[model samples]
Target: MSMKHLKYCPELNQITGSINATILLLQLEYWFAKMTGGKFYKFLDSCEHELYKQGDSWVEELGFSKQEFRTAFSKIGKVYTSKKAFKESKDLFNGKYYASYYDRIKGLTYYIRNDAKLSELFDDDSNKILYSEEKSTENTEDVLRTPQIIIPANPKTSSPLSVEYNKLLTSVKDTHPTKVCVPYETIKALFNQYCPSYPQLTLLTAKRKTLLKKLWYDMGQTLENFKQAFLSAENSDFLSGRLGSWRASFDWLIQEDKFVALLEGCYTNNRRQSQFSPSTPSAPKPHSKFTTMYSHYWDFEELEKLEDQYIDRQIAKYSTMSVALD
Candidate 1:
């Protein structure tokens, strides 16, 4: 009970009342948000500095044939002091918490590019194959129609992402294939990630969902229509590159007397990845506040975009409902 950082508790049963969960989460969120301010991006910059330094400091110590860099970075990140303050977003694109936090998590699992140059200048093309999804670059923003949605103060209390996400992965009614949308349930995994030090039910409420559901039309259609809305969500997203993963990993860092680098086992040849964990020994440097702000500008912009998308979704839902009733 000294203070739990991030711990997983499989046996931690889901809360019975959504209201109870919502209230509890609201309390925790108050503190978490307070510590993670508008300057969240600056925090990511600091994380990068640490990753770069740690990677280099422990490269020789790891002694892997390929020279494991993430492990070193993870070890250092796990012990860093900041992990005790910020809480990470469970899903980066759910349009909830900052995107940079989400990017940090994916960076640990997938070696995504921050910029094009991060790709290797390999002597042979055969050596540089990454089984990544083919990125579609067509700007569909023009074809976009305003989507309708119900927004409550908190998605956790208002929507159950766990329930909705599970269904989205399955085949929807065969008749409706033209559109696809994400519901609150699909995003539950993010909210309920196990904090290894002390895992428990978040206890968020469903009132937000109830309010939106009544104010809006067919919730299913709202989610379905969102397919287009969310296409570039993870891409152009403020959390798109360095800040994304940096933030998420940083989120895991907060709340712990000791931090564990979840990315310790990850490997990447990407230059940004390498730079963040440069495999050299150097002392940590004091970060300039401006540098931190620069890294997170996208976060502020992304959150605004999400707010816009939510309003648009509500509009779309309104139209569809009227037509159906007519």
Candidate 2:
């Protein structure tokens, strides 16, 4: 029989004390099974290891959110930095062997435990264990034969660790929809270059990160769009603090409504007015009433002249009709 599905052991939950960790362990076992030359004692030396990248497609394939995956992966045990020290027998786990090692450049590698309690679950012999589909519908006990543990009538109250674990699990279960990946540092750099006068973004807090990710996704997920947004802010008189004391900052620019307005040229400079002009200024010219409304495009003075001519023609036609009637 071909090993098509992963067999889950209830003992893993007992060992890890978490359902998320149990699921991750099963998935990791599935991956390890695919490695060539068979499983061995030490990680990166005896057995082949897989490098797990965060936010990879396999994470979703295993039905885990990013946060859930991270939490579950951490529960496995300490991740060693040095491969030499990790290979040493003294550094290995004493009783139940479960180790993880991480490198900054290469990424994360795991070593699943191969203890007697869970040995049968990881066995190469596929026919020994019954898959869910092959199991008899009458009883599930045949498929999962978990050893019964005697519990006291009055179990001890939950510990702080258990409470915190429960909270983490709750957060994992309540996962938000995956966000579009945004180049946050690149955007920050662009903001710094373009809006030099505005408040600089030194620290990217959790709230700011959330806002930026949302903005990047909403704004079509392009660096060029971000560039244009920054440029628009740079050219704006009000936003650049030329028109007012209050100036636009990174926080103000990322707001959806405000960003949309900025792109629509709402806050842009109306004319090419200089910031610092001569003390002797030119006399102000009289402008049409509609000047403020159409100042960006139309010549309101010409519009006023056209209106006067139309009124004159209408008056002349009415007088000519009255004279003919008389």
Candidate 3:
């Protein structure tokens, strides 16, 4: 199935998870509209884009009158803007003016081009804004030229991971018969995301079951805490196998003392200390051809700075050579 990139702010769900269903839909619609048409459409006078049309005609196309559109936008905007999570995070709306439009187009195009059967939570039918074939045929060529974006079809059925997760959840509840049960898939997804370099381990394993039970039940740590602790372990040079063959694994994460230490930020703080302090003299370890070295902490900004310095040096060297030739 094809992937149409949608302008999704994941933090929106996090911030507004408890909001009313109708209000949630209103927010989504506003986000979709803002994504298709530029936010500058709100102030038509200053919009420099050639594709931007004058007046309420553009707004009308979104199935909302001027007043209704404004109200919808305002209501959702207030909900999100008031949220600390939303305020702390950045999204398409935070960057360039045209970001929302492009994101909406990509997201729309994804569903249109891909298979249907998306999850009920994010069904494609809910996003039926436009891009019908009859009109699409006429506007296909110009659609690319214009500011408009194609809203893709939704394949809002069950995904393999979701099915597996749900199945696991039901099984766990049945077997344990407990009042408290952690969502395995959520924690698994978080681990995969935050610790990409680590080996992909499944919670369905016997060892993993024990580990998760310890973290979730025995410790009473929330999913968020587990995620942070996982990140901490991943960032540790010693624990992640950077310094030696001894590296922490999924099973190691649940060790009673180790897990408690990680939760207390001891591991993360130690890693930070190592980064800032001068390296101490130590015995050199044997290195094999297969022993791959990775950065202890890779920072994008640091890499960018190094890249800029390299580019400047190249430019200066080239200028000197040109002068010599002259």
Best by TM-score: 2
Q: Evaluated with lDDT, which candidate comes out highest?
A: 2
Worst 10 residues of 3 by lDDT: 108-117
Clashing pairs counted in every model: 54, 0, 20
lDDT of 1 by residue, 112-231 (tens): 111111122212441222111223343422111111211122223433235664254122212333333334453233323222112322432465334323212222334322222122
Winner on lDDT (2 vs 3): 2
Off by over 4 Å in 1: 1-28, 32-92, 95-266, 271-326
What is candidate 3's lDDT per residue for 1-326, written digit by digit as tens? 43221222222334334222223233344444445311222321223444445532324233333333333333333222112222233441231111111111111110010011112234454345321223344433223211122222133633333555446423522433246576777877776666654677665676676667656864545787787777777666667665666877777776755776676555652222332211222213326523434355778678656744553454345445545654
Candidate 2 CA-lDDT value: 0.52
- Model 1: weakest 10-residue lDDT segment is 109-118
TM-score of each: 0.16, 0.32, 0.29
| lDDT value, candidate 3, whole model | 0.42
TM-score of candidate 1 relative to the true fold: 0.16
Q: On a 0 to 1 TM-score scale, where does candidate 3 land against the true structure?
A: 0.29
What is the descending lDDT order? 2, 3, 1
The residue-level lDDT of candidate 1 at 125 comes to 44
Off by over 4 Å in 3: 1-179, 269-326
